[model samples]
Target: MTRTTVTARPAEPSVVARLSALDRWLAVWILLAMALGLGLGRAVPGLNDVLAKVEIGGISLPIAVGLLIMMYPVLAKVRYDRLDAVTSDKKLLVSSLVINWLVGPAVMFALAWLFLPDLPEYRTGLIIVGLARCIAMVIIWNDLACGDREAAAVLVALNSVFQVLAFGLLGWFYLDLLPGRLGLGDGQHLDVPMAKIALNVVVFLGIPLIAGFLTRRIGERRMGRDAYEAKFLPRIGPWALHGLLFTIVVLFALQGKTITSQPLDVARIALPLLVYFALMWFGTFALGKVIGLAYDRTATLAFTAAGNNFELAIAVAIATFGVTSGQALSGVVGPLIEVPVLVGLVYVSLAWRRKFAVRGRA
Candidate 1:
C-alpha cells in the first residue's frame, strides 16, 4: 500500500478583494470629481446652466438619471429570498430600525439645530439628510468591514422601502410641525412637498429596486445562477461606481460656485455632520454589543445606522429647493464629509473586530 500526502492549498483572497478599481479607490475618485467639478464650474461659463436646464418637476433630468444608474447595481446584488432572515433575527432588525429611523433622526435634528440655528435653510437640509437611511453606499462599507453582505442587502432593501413610505410624512412632522411647536425656526413655512418626495423615492429607490430584481431574475433564469453571479453581475457592477462618480461630478459642478464662494459656510455644515456620524456609529455599536450580536452583524448595523442615503437626500434637496440653493448645497456637502468619516469607521470596525470579536465569529 502506497501512502499519498495531501497538501492544503493557499487560501484565496476575499470576495471584497474582487471589487473593481473604482470601489477600491472610492475616496480618491470622489476627490477627483470634486476637483474636476470646481475647475469646470470656475473655468466653463455656461455648463452648469445647460445641465440645470435639463429638468423636470424641479429634478434635474441628467442628475436624476445618473442617480438611478448608481442605485440599480447595488439593488441587484440583494438576495431578497434571504429576507426571512431579517424577521428570524428580530432583535437585529428591530434594533437597526430603532437606531436608523428613531435615534438616528433625533440625533441629527439636535446637532443641526444646535449648530445651524441661525441658518434655517441649511438646518432644514441637514434635518432632511438625517431622515434618509443609507440604501446604497452602506453596501460598500459593509463589504469593507467584512460584514454579512446578504444581511446588509436585506437591511438596504428594507430602508429603501421605508424611505419611500415615510420620508415625506417624517419631513413634515419633524422639520415643520415639531420645529414649529418647539419654536426652533422663525414662523416660516417649511413646505415639504409630498409629491416631490414621493417622486424622488419612486425614481431613485423603487425603480432601481424593481429593475434590479428583474435583471437578476431574468439573468439567472437564462444564464443559470453560477454564470449569472460570476460573469454578468461583475460586468454590470462597475456601472454603479461610474454612475456615482459622474453624479458627484454633476452635483459639485452645479454647486461649485456656492461651495467655492463660501468655503467657511460649507465648512460649518461639516461640524454637525462629523459629530452626527461619530455619535450615531458608536452609539449603535454599543447597542449591538449590549444585544450580543456577532461582530459581522454589529458592523452591519453600525454602517447602516450611520450611513446616509446622500443620493436621495441630494435629489430631494434639489427637487424641493433649486439646483444651487443652500438646501441643495447642504445635501452636496453630505458625501464630501461622509466618505472620509465612514472610511475611518471602517478601520475602527476592523480594529475592534480583531481585538474583541469572539473566536471564530469574524
Candidate 2:
C-alpha cells in the first residue's frame, strides 16, 4: 500500500487567484506608494531626517528591516530543491549566468560612461544598478509572460548566490580600478568595501535564504509539500509585496526634497536605465531564439536577465554611499523607472509569444 499526503483544499476563489491579480496592478501601487512617500516627506519636514537618524553601520534600521522583509519571502519561494534540476539544461543555465553576471554589467558600465560621462555620481549609481541582477520582480514578469516558473526560480536562486559573492569585487573593478586604468573621468574613486558587501549579503540574502530553506523544509515535513506550497507559500507571499510598497515609500520619503528640486537629475539617472533594460531584454530574447531555445526557456532567460534587484541595490547605496549621496539617489530612482518599463516588457513578451510561436526546451 502507498502512503498518501493530505493537502489544503482550494477555496472557490483561491488565495493564489487573488494574489495573482496583485502583480498586474503592481505598477499602480508603486506609483501610489511613490506619491504618498514623496508627499509625506515634503509635508512632514523632519520625518525623513528622523528616520535617517536611527541607524547602525550607516544603514537606517527601519529601512534595513523593510529591505529584509522585501527580500526573504521572494528568496524563500525560489525552488532551491529544483536548482540542480536546472543544470540539466546547461546551455540555458550557462547563458543566463554569463549574461546576468558579465554581459549585463559590461553594458551598463559602457552605457553609463557613454551617456553620463560628466556626471560621476550618477554614473557610479547606474553601474551599481547594473551590477545588481533581479531577484524578485522577474518572478512576476516570468509569470506574466507564461515562462517556465521553475526555471525562473532556479535562476533567481543562483543569481542571489552569485550577487552575494561578486557584487563588491565587481564594484571595485568597474567603478574604481578599471576606470583609473581606462581613464574614465577620474574613475569616481568610489570606495565600496568587500566587508560591507559581505555584510549586506549575510544580512539580506544569507539570513533569508537560510530562514526560507529551514521554514520550507520544516513546513513540508510537518504539513506535506502540497499543503506547504498551497497554504503556506501564499500566506507568506504577500510579505514581499507589502514590504516592497513600504520600501518605495520610505525611499522616496528620504529623497523627496532632492528629487523634487532636481527633476532633470532624475531624468539623467533614468536615461541609462531605460537603455539598459531594453538592451538586456531584447538582446537576451534574440540570443535565446538564435540558440534555438524554446519559448518558455527563452522567456525565462530574457526576463531573468532584464530585471534588477533594486531593493538590494537601494539598501547598499544608502549604506555604502550616503543617504543624500548621488549614488543613493540613483538607487532610489531605479524602481521608479524599472516598474513601468518592466510592465511594458511584459506586454511585449506576450505579443512576441503570439508572433513567433517558437517551441523547444533550452
Candidate 3:
C-alpha cells in the first residue's frame, strides 16, 4: 500500500494540470470573495446597505441565487432511477446517512462545547450548523474525495428530503439549550423561522433539484451515461462554484461590519472551528473504515460528515440571535474557513486512498 502524505504531491502541478485543478482551489475563490466584500463594505458601507437589502419578505436574493446554484448540480446528479443499479451498494447509502446526520452533528456539538466554552452562542451555532446537513457541496467534496458519486447523489436527495421534515424539530431541539432573547429581539423558537427557510429550500433545493433530476434522466435516457456525465456534470461544477462565490461575496459583505468590529474574536471562533473540522474529518473517515467501507465511500462519509449546509445555520441565526450576535457570527464564520479547510481535507483523503484501498483489498 502506498501510504503517502499530501506533501509528496509535486511542488507544483503543470499548467494544464493546474487548469484541471481549478476545483481544488475553490478555497482561493471563496477567500477572494471575502476580500472583495471587505473592500466594498469598508469603502462604501452603502454598498452593504444596497446589497444586503435585495430581500423579499426578508429573505435575501443572493442567498436564494446561491441556493439554486448549489442544488442544480446536486439535483442534476441525482438519478431517481439509478438506485436500481447501485442498490447493490447499500453500505454506501447507510454509512453516509448515519455519519452525515447522526454522527456528524454529535461530533460537532462535542467539539464546540469542549473547545469553545468561552463562546456559548457561537458554540451552539456550531451545533446548529452541523444539524443543517449537506446540500450541494457534498458532491464536490465527494468527487474530490473520490467517493462513489452515485451513492453521494442518493444521499443528497435523502438529506434534502429529511432536512425539511426535521429542520424545525432539530433546530428547536438543539438550540433549546440556549435561552432566547425575545424581549431584546430574536425569536422565541429557532425553528419557527424555518417556514421562511422552507420556502427558501423549495426555491433553492426543491426547484433546481426537480429540474436537475429531470435533466439528468432525460440526458441519460437520450445520450447515455458517458456523454451525460462528460457533458453536463462537469459544467454544473463551475455553475455551483459561481453560485457559492456569489453567496460568499454577499455573506462577507453583510458580515464584514461584524467581523471588523470585534476582529480578535475571529481567532476565538476560528480556533474551535479548526478543532471541529479535524475532529469531524477524522472521526467520520475512521468510522467509515471501521465499519468496513472502502476508500471511496469512506472519503464521502468523511467529507459529508465534516461539511454543513450553513444556510440553515445562517437563517436560524438571524431568526434566533439577530444578525450581529455571537451565534450569527459563528454561522458566517463556517463558510469563511469551510472551503479552504475542506480543500486540505480533499488532499488528505486522496493521499490516504492507497492505504485504505490496500486494507479494503485485504
Candidate 4:
C-alpha cells in the first residue's frame, strides 16, 4: 500500500529528429541549389566557360575540388581500423559484386535500349554511367542514411579497384560487343582508354582517401578516439554538405542552358534514369533484407549499388565523344536526376530504420 510512484523512461527522439537543422532540410536545400545553378547558368553569360577553364583530366577543377571536400569529411569519419570485419563478410562482398557488376549494368543497358532506342548517344551514355559504379558521392548518401560507415568505406574501396580493372572491359562489352550480339549496334563503338579511367580513380578516390586516412590517424594519435570522434569530427562534418551543395550548384549551372533549351531530350534521358535508380535501390535494399543484413549494412549496400560515378561517366563521355555530343549531355543529366532521387531514398531509408527499431523492440 506504500506503493511507489514509478517513472517511465522517455522514448528516444527519432533519427530524423536527431539531425541538425541543415541535415533535416537537406532535400529542400538540394532543390534550391539546383534552381540556383540553373538560374545562374541561364542568367550569366560565359559562366560555363569560366568554370571550364580549370580542368583536371577532363573534369572541371572546381567540381573536382568540391568532390574532394565533400568526400573527405565522411571518409575521415570512417573507422578504418574496423574494415577487417567488413571484408570478412563474404556475403556482403559477393552480393555487392554480383549486383554491381552483373545486374546493374545489364539493367541499365536494357532500360537505355528500351527507353531511348532512337537516341543512341544517350543510350550509350547511360550504359557508361552504369558501368562506372559509385565511388565518390555514395559515401555521403550512405552516411546520411545512417549506414555502417566502415562497411561503406570497404565497399567503396572495393569498387574503386573493380572500376579500374573492369570499367574499360565492361564498356567495350556493353557498348560494342553485347550490342553487336543483340543486332542492336549501329556500327558505333565506344573505346574508353584504361589510362584515363585509372587516372580518374587515382585522383578522385585516392587523393581524398589518403588524406582522410592520414587525418584520422594523426587526429586519433594526438587527441584520442573519443575526442577525435566527438569534438574534432563535429567541427568538420558540415563541410561535407557544403561541398555537396556547391558541387550541385556548379554542375547545374554548367549544364543549365542545355537542360533548359532541350526539355524534350532531357525528359527522354530522365525517364530511363529514374527507372534505373528506383529499381536498383529498392531491389538491392530488398535483397539485403532477404539475406538478413542489419539495417545499417543494408542501407550501405542499397546506396552503393544505386549511386553512380557521375564524374567518371561525364569525363569518359566528354573525352570520347566531345563535350557537345548527346553522350556528354546524358552524362550531365545523371547527377541532376540522381541527387533528388537519392535524397528521397534517404528519407525512405530512415523510415525503414524506424520500422527496424520497432521490430527489434517488439
TM-score of each: 0.84, 0.81, 0.81, 0.95
lDDT per residue, candidate 4, 172-282, as tens digits?
A: 888888888889864356677778888888877899899999999999999999999999999999999999999999999988888899999999999999999999999
lDDT of each: 0.76, 0.76, 0.70, 0.88
- Candidate with better lDDT, 1 vs 4: 4
- Structure candidate 3, residue pairs in collision: none
Give candidate 2's whole-model lDDT: 0.76
Model 1 worst lDDT run, 10 consecutive residues = 1-10
Winner of 2 and 4 under TM-score: 4
The Cα RMSD of model 1 versus the native structure comes to: 6.1
Name the runs in model 4 displaced over 4 angstroms.
1-12
Which residues of candidate 2, in runs, are more than 4 Å off? Answer: 1-21, 71-79, 136-150, 180-183, 311-321, 350-362
| TM-score of model 4 vs. true structure | 0.95
Better of 1 and 2 by TM-score: 1
- As for TM-score, the candidate ahead, 1 or 3, is 1
Compute the lDDT of residue 242 as modeled in candidate 3.
76
TM-score of 2: 0.81
Top candidate, metric TM-score: 4
Candidate 4 worst ten-residue window by lDDT: 1-10
Write model 2 residue lDDT over 178-294, tens digit each, in one string.
888986645545455666655655665567667877887888899999998889888888887787778778877876777777799999988889999999999999998887666
RMSD in order of candidates: 6.1, 5.6, 5.7, 5.7
Query: In model 3, where do residues sit more than 4 Å from their true spots?
Result: 1-21, 77-80, 85-90, 177-194, 221-226, 231-237, 357-362
